[model samples]
Target: MLLADSPPPELQTLTRGQYDLVEYALAGAGFALLAYALYSWTSRSEVGVRYRPAVMLGLCVGAVAALSYLLLFLRWGAGYDLTDAGYVPTDQARLALSPRYVDWSVTVPLLTAELLAVCSLAGARARKLRASTMTAAFLMILTGHLGAQVVGEGRDTTALVLWGLVSTAFYGYLYVALIGAVRSSIPTIGREAAVSLRNAAIVLLATFGVYPLVYAVPVFVDVTAAWLTAIQLAYSAADVLAKVGFGVLVHKVAKLRTAEDVAAGVDTHPEAVWVSNVEHSRAVLPPAQPPAMATSPTTPTA
Candidate 1:
């Protein structure tokens, strides 16, 4: 049957204003994310080698998310038709959620990797922590997608709610892991670096919190034009902040720690910013002191 004839709960009829709003938001966010990803790419050379891994992960996250959003925008463009009332689905239609779920599955794990890269822990403990957190994040995205599929197939509120709760359980685990990582790293870095790391964690948590909120919308209200517009807008806003904004914040903390290490002579930066920093360091050094003993000592010895 045509989607218009038997529309899934995941698909919604949207007024022109609502459709335009979602379209613009997705396109704008895609461009913004790509820009930030490029920025992150260039910044990798500015930091110490030890912290480059986190910045690399952030770059990957941004690129993956940017591509997904752009694909979603294109899908939106082709999925619907301009009807008398507004925009409605064409014959064969599906929500652009598949791309989003695929994006989250990859990017979510990369985010956890980024966090762990900056973390102070090492060896087997670090490996264990990384494994658990990444696994939990992937499971969270997986379960959430299951909920969306439940909605797409049938308006099965019960299955959707159950899946949502399962996803929430995984999200809660990830939060615990993140908080622990932040708290543990505080004592290992300088005061400023610690503060930046802590703040990044807080902002990340706040931005990520928007996902569950967006996920729960279909649970609470019918997917009408206005509500659907709200959902798309919220998801787009959260995507930009969570991937691009959070990635930048993590990079800041990494850069700060690298600077701290360089200051203390614990780390060296041989690329990009280091060349200028080295010259500036030499310019500020005190002049060498004259020899205490004069040439007279050498004359007496002769």
Candidate 2:
């Protein structure tokens, strides 16, 4: 059935106008953040080559998130109703399939990797942690996107609730993994870097918790355009915290690690002090002692 054939909700035009205004403002902010992230990535020489990859990953997270928000703004500005086309009769298509989900699907895993990478985990352990963390993060976002799809389709409340629960479970697992990864790195990366990484992870997890709350509100209560606006705004704020803010935090951790390496002289010479000494003495031998003759003379005198 055509959307025009069905009765529309009592949408306040003024509310939509306000939403548009807010979206535009957010878009501008997103652009600015994106620019900053790119600049940071490009100017990574400030942190030195050792930290470039980790810092680049963080910058990528910010850039991707800002791009996502800008896409959402464009979607909202286009006036395309989310509930425009669906098979279910009661499923009035209101939730526009905003590109936010698309963005999340790509960026979320990268964000997880970024968090883990800045810790400078070594060899096989780093690979394992990155794999596990990225897997969990990908699952978390996948389930959440699926749940959003179900809700957008006007599915039964029970279905929506179940999806929400599943997504939440994935999120819980993801958070635990993130914390574990950060904590495990303390012995390797030092307490300062570990603490910084932990704080960034916590900030991300905390901000992400708000998404489910914002999503649940509309599912259980009467939803209006204003409420939709609130959801968008809340999500935007969370994105900034989780992505841009977290990126900055990750950068700080990388910077700290770089400084520590420089101070320890590891950046220039990675060999242990004893090993360095051995290498230095390779061309020289200890002077031979006339020990046997000295001992014999002393014994005779006694």
C-alpha TM-scores of all predictions: 0.85, 0.74
Q: Work out candidate 2's RMSD over C-alphas.
A: 12.7
Question: All candidates: CA RMSD in angstroms?
Answer: 8.0, 12.7
Q: Give the per-residue lDDT of model 2 (tens digit) for 1-302.
A: 11222222223232445456556657765876697588667757545466677677777776877777666665555544434231121222243334667777777788888777776566898888788777877777777767666454433455557777887887888788777877777778767667787789888789878878965663566555556556666767777777777877777777667656655656632322122123211122225666674343445553
| Tens digits of lDDT, candidate 1, 196-286 | 7787788777877888887776566655557667777888898888877777777877877777776676666553233323421111223
Model 2, residue 291: C-alpha shift (Å): 44
* Candidate 1 Cα lDDT to native: 0.78
Give the number of the best model, judged by TM-score. 1
Give the Cα lDDT of each candidate. Answer: 0.78, 0.64
Q: What C-alpha lDDT, on a 0 to 100 scale, does residue 162 get in candidate 1? A: 83
